[model samples]
Target: MDGFDRFRAPPPDMLVMRPLDSMVAIFHRPSGRTHVVASPVPEILESLGPDPTDVATLLARLSERFDLAAGDREALLARLGELEAAGLVERL
Candidate 1:
């Protein structure tokens, strides 16, 4: 994959998001599971639209709305991995 992984959220109807104080509760319809996510995780999910997006593009989109640190790239990659594992996001 050249280490430039692309990701996309499932269809809107497949997931339901609810905001809690510092976390978001996401219900994955297909799995009948709910995931509790925090911080950049929620932002990341919100940034992903219907189209698949690469890391660079996703970072750009996030930057427009949030103040990101230089080390965020590594953190983002790690979070994406977590989200993928949780079925919250799909790696395309």
Candidate 2:
């Protein structure tokens, strides 16, 4: 997979998310940890069972939900990359 693939929605068993204040907190239950995350661009939290969604799908959803501009999309993806690398999230 390429770098973009890492932005996927993550596997069901490996993740959980809840809305908190204006932010969303994603949890990696297998590791008993969580991270508070937010994006100016909107997205729906989806559960994909053992499998995870692809990054393109996620970007599409976010773009649709928030009508994000190219710059916003890039920024949001960048922040998500940081979260993923921190083990606060995983790509399936």
Best candidate per lDDT, number?
Answer: 1
lDDT of 1: 0.86
TM-score of each: 0.90, 0.58
Instruction: Write down the TM-score for model 1.
Output: 0.90
lDDT of 1 by residue, 1-92 (tens): 32489999888888899999888998999999999888887788889865799989998999999899998888888888889999888998
What is the per-residue lDDT of model 2 for residues 1-92, given as tens digits with 9 covering 90 to 100? Answer: 35456444446657676788898887777777777777441243452123466666666766665666667546655655665677644565
Cα-lDDT of candidate 2: 0.57
- Clash totals for all candidate models: 0, 0
Least lDDT summed over 10 consecutive residues: which range in candidate 2? 41-50
| CA error at residue 45 for candidate 2, angstroms | 5.5
Q: List the lowest-lDDT window of 10 residues for candidate 1.
A: 1-10
